[model samples]
Target: MSFHEGGPRAAQQKDTRSPGTGAGTVALFTLATIMCLLALAATYYFFVRTTTGQFIDESALVRADTIRGRAGRASTEFLDWLPVTSLVIAAVVVLFVTIVRRRWTAAGIAVAACMLANLATQLLKDWLPVRPYRGVQTLELNSLPSGHTTLAASAAAAVFLMVSPRWRPLAGFLGGTFAVASGVSTLINQWHRPADVIAAFLVVAAVMLPAGWLVLRTGKDWNAWDGDGGHWASSRFWVLLPGIAVVVSAAVAAYALRELILGMEVTDSTSSYFWAGAAMIVGTGHFAMVAAVWLFSWAARRRGPARR
Candidate 1:
């Protein structure tokens, strides 16, 4: 066959091989799902079951009390606004995309998974045993998998799911920032421990990863797009910003921890623990979103000439 004729045929063959249907994609997503679950379990065990972990967790909450003048009220207000904000944003984005692109099945799956993530958070909160007394003078109530964080993250995940691949990096970064802000607000408001916020992230990842796999499988045609930098939203800035945030947040947390271990006075309204917990929240949330961006970017089809 002539080179021109063979080119079109080869392109047709490549297009038929949907991006997310490969064995490698399945293994990667499955590994991610399992990792989230294990992380959730580990967060619960360390924070709720161990003495040192409980001490640090409770200390962070206690330190948050020192900064309760203006920041606390603002955080409380933000938490109060979270439900309405999440619902409106999720509904608007999902509906607009579904209508614009006629992505009915993908939208349905995203919305359903979003709901399930939220419900699972509530169930885990109730079903998980109360925090064991590990010589920490704290409340006995069970607050793992923060409800507010779950709502925010799941809503963000829904929006992330509905957008085309070119828009996902931007969407993921923004969504992750929203989730991190919600988690930090909960901490500043003294509503949950760091582990609770972290668990919520895991819960969202656990549910959304599988839902995303289904999205790729069902919406193969619509998922194709030029690789990163082909559009403004697909630029590397989105991923880079989050990666930088993760690094900065990790440094902050490490410094705070080192101060604590070196016998520095951290309990005299220093708020060091609070800052560390907030950093943890920011780092975990951004890392999760970054992973989502990378995963879906790999899974989505890039329209290009077929490889020889």
Candidate 2:
């Protein structure tokens, strides 16, 4: 209907995503999802399947063995509670926000995304062939995408999706941090390899990106936002902290794992370098995702002041 016949209320309900920006957003999200899936493939192939990969993968377990004591037990105990606790908290928070905002479609999209991510993890784990015994000491079963890490990351992503764009950067940072910490905790506890944690994150990204686009498309008014104001708390600090985290962690990981690249016949399982490298992967993956999603939202932002 024309604007006049459609009336004020009808016009008010118009989509916030403009046609020009909508196409771009769709393209960006599609590419991001594909890239994440590709990265996931590379991680599984290079870090989980090969003989060299198994050697590197089991290195962290060597460190975990050394640290087996009260500290290790305590860490495992905490992580045991993390998956359920984080999801419950994320669900409650997201549900409250979605209800208050009354964005029913957005809520559905977020929940569906979370469920699909977790389900995909389990399905992939069961369907993938068992890891070949490449003379590695690690378990032979397929453990690509970790169930715990998938649950944690998807929970956080759900919360990140439900928040307003103005608040999303900060929320994304916090959510991603929680997810990364959960992944690292699994490593420190010896429950999963770094590749498992990394794969879980990639799976969450693949599922959530397209779901996020749907949320934006259906709840356009709620998703729209203005450019970041001069407030440090708003956007600058959110992106800055994660940026620095990714940089520092990358440097440390590169330095710590340089021997692997040098072809030195070192297979020490008790090396702290393994844990450091795993933590670095977790940090880099989660933070980079936060920045990417935030940049997309910022690009699609409305130019004028936020709607009243």
lDDT of each: 0.88, 0.74
User: Model 1 shows how many backbone clashes?
Assistant: 0
Total clashes in model 2, counting residue pairs 3 or more apart in sequence or in different chains: 0
Candidate 2 structure quality by residue, lDDT tens digits, 1-308: 68676876444445444422456666777888898899889888887779877777778655756666786777688797997788787879877987787878878888999999999999999988888788878778887888888888898888877876667777777878878877777777888888888889899989988888777667656566655663333566777777788878877766666777777766574465565546665675656555555754664464323331
Could you tally the backbone clashes for each prediction? 0, 0
Tell me the RMSD of model 1 versus the true structure.
2.9
lDDT by residue (1-308, candidate 1, tens digit) is 88866786467545765666899999999999999999999999999999867877888888888878799889899999999999999999999999988999999999999999999999998999998888899998999999999999999999998898888888998899999999999988889999899999999999999999998888876676676777898899999999999999999998877755786654535678888888999999999999999988887744442121
Error of 2 at 64 (Å): 2.2
Model 2 residue runs over 4 Å out of place are 1-21, 68-71, 230-233, 267-270
Error of 1 at 121 (Å): 0.5
Model 1 lowest lDDT segment of ten: 299-308
Model 2 lDDT-worst window of ten: 299-308
